[model samples]
Target: MQNAGDWTRRLREIGIYAVIGAFLTIISPYNGSGNLPLWGAYLYWTGLVLTGSLSAEATRTLMERTGRKFGVPVMLALMSVTSALAVTAMIILLEALTSGRSIPPGYLPRLFGLVWVIAAAVTAVGIMIERTVLAPVTEPVKGASPEETFLSRLPVKYRTAELYAVSAEDHYLRIHTSHGEELILMRLADAMRELAGADGLQVHRSWWVAKSAVRDTRKQGSKLSLVLPSGKEAPVSRTFQAEVKAAGLSA
Candidate 1:
């Protein structure tokens, strides 16, 4: 299921990039293919846009994994600059291959500037789409036992135990309960759907905590965590800090 979702997301991204590429081809920005036929222009722009967009996304993901906090504007700027440099090199290579002559050193700076503008625009659009269109839609599970939906999926031993938290680990989820912890082959987003009506909140990108299981809130510098009865702590990311605080889970 996770693999299927991943493929769907990839296809959607490719489709969006392809549209943007087609638009660029129509406009023929910077006279990128002034001498080429229409079909050749389409091929060049589509490939270039797809490559640049993917490169920007990779840089953004790497930046996120660094664990260093950055404002959205700053992160976008950094991603655009990094991707622009990489794409500029690709552009130079492509020009050399097609024109049988390398781009002059004097034109390198201008080329980089053009690439940066396009990179920044595309990067911003991609982020907006991810936050909006690609975000998970969690509807409430209407029933007497909202927790039952997810509890039934737990190991037999933990079916009656109190759920403490659910943390994502690669392709699986680590279910924390009063009895013990168990790993399940499930995505956090899927788990979240089942847990929609449960008395809990997603405290981090990779963590969801039951409200009843929280003993107190812990703060260290700028970091915040929800302390559970079992001595387990669920870290709260900046993105969800406001929701955690509103839920009275913050100190």
Candidate 2:
């Protein structure tokens, strides 16, 4: 379902490229064999943009996959490649469609070279903008919500008992605490994103317990449980029981 969101967002972005391609195709109408109408050109460009700019992971996921720290250069390159592919494919589709038939023999080379060069330019600009401006502005929006900030800046500390981690409850976050968990609203990934610095690990689809609050670790057969400070026990599935144990806590 979240991937559906990503797909939808990708299509919308490609559609923006299509819109630009439509304007350009109209500017210099292809005078080849077909002389396709403006709408057809637009549709072709849209489809092409969708094809070329297929879904790729967002900056964060890409970093995690690469097992390297996120790099400003890499992220910018990715975004630029994304934008250029979307833009280039749209242009090619328009050029081909206007020819009324097959893609031109010489089109492939130009498409390849143009995509890489333009992608580099776009990536550079995108990277510059993100590091210089966008990242600074958006950084606070991640977990530094107003309320969270207020809590952080409180005259007295308040988060001494909270436990945080991803919970896969139909794509929602189930935040656990000494007070027991309340599904405080957030995407599992986004919730994990905010909880990145906290000392907790996602142990299951329905749980994420803090190490400090783990009262006791007990196992019956293969199942393990994390007893909380309040005497409530949260199950630690086999998948993450090892992690809990490795963290020097019993399971």
Candidate 3:
């Protein structure tokens, strides 16, 4: 089932890029490339767009793995720069191979600028699609536990254990449960979607706690944290403190 979902997401992403590629082909932005035959132009833009998109995706994944949060605009800027560099290199190589000529050093910067524009546009579109089209449906399944979907991702021994909280550790998530704790390779953002049906709210950028698992609230100076059964504490960031209080977890 997980594999199926992954494939569906990949196909949708490819479709979105293909549409953008087609649009670029029609417009023919570059003066030299605009003179190419229709078929050749289509192939050129589509291939480049797909390659650039993949490069951007890889950059985004790498950034996420570093465990440092970035605002949307900053993230997009980083991805665009990385993708532009990769695509620019690809373009230079292809031109040299096909035309037996190297792009002049002075012209390389301009070529990168053009590629950056396309990369930024594609990155923005991909982010929008992820937030809208590919976001997980939060509705509960009929006749099933609210946490069923999320629990399914746990190891067999932990599947039936009551979920306590989840904390981010680099590119992995440390799952705390009634039985014990375990680690899984998944992003906190993606885990939140799977955990939507569970009775929990994100208490911090890196922590999500099940209301039932929060035994008490801990305060140190102006900071707040949620104490769980196993003596583990999940810090509640100022950003989410209001939500935690409103949910009665901070009481």
Candidate 4:
């Protein structure tokens, strides 16, 4: 489900970049500045800008996968620097080929420096659009009613109850809320998807607990478990011990 949302955002980003590229090309100050025809020049600029945008997105993805913690300024700096380098390299190569000019000695550095300035400008615009426009459009509004959020995914009777934990029982899931426990036909993975807005995580392959429902955590030798509001214990597998501890649920 997260991947679906990412894909949707990616498509929207591409569409936006394409439209901006077209607009920039139409009003380009450098149109027909060289041997290239006006139409060809426009196409070239539009394609170049779109290519740069895609490169920026790829860089952002790589940074995210690295999982390195960074503050806002640091993240922006890393992204902008990487994006500028990638786009500048591509632009230099493209310009050399399209302009039919041999790589001028001692001119490469100057060209790259100049191109980086342009790439930096484009990256700034892209970041602004993502934070101000795309983010607001994609993210649910703040202070949403609980009834309209993850709580609504429970069975009709349990909908208004306080959520505790979810346990996978073979092909079904057993939901334990404040009201009572009930078995439902659903996968833990799918249930987690529906509980996106909830503050929780899978403490084991078969168990997911709401942070608020955890009354205590216990460690028996190498194993860990969470004690819920209903006195039900949810085991935490070794695989998830780190996550449980990160949530400050470890004894």
lDDT of each: 0.80, 0.52, 0.80, 0.70
Best by TM-score: 3
Across residues 73-106, which tens digit of lDDT does each residue of candidate 3 receive? 7878999999889888887887887778888999
lDDT of 1 by residue, 109-220 (tens): 9989988998899888876676446533333346636665576655456667888999997766788888777655578998887888789999999999999999988899
User: Which candidate, 3 or 4, has the higher TM-score?
Assistant: 3
Cα error of candidate 1 at position 251, Å: 13
* TM-score for each model: 0.59, 0.35, 0.63, 0.48
Q: Would you list the rank order by lDDT, best first?
A: 3, 1, 4, 2
Cα RMSD to native, each candidate? 9.6, 13.8, 7.2, 13.4
Candidate 4 lDDT for residue 106:
90
Sort the candidates on TM-score, descending order: 3, 1, 4, 2
Count of backbone collisions in candidate 4? 0
Superposed model 2: Cα runs more than 4 Å off: 1-161, 164-168
Specify the poorest-scoring 10-residue window by lDDT in model 1.
135-144
lDDT of 3 at 30: 60
Worst 10-residue lDDT window for candidate 3 reads 131-140
Query: Native-vs-model 4 lDDT?
Result: 0.70
Colliding pairs, model 2: none
- Per-residue error for 119 in candidate 1, Å, reads 0.7
After TM-score superposition, the amount by which residue 177's alpha carbon in candidate 2 deviates from its true location, in angstroms, is: 2.4
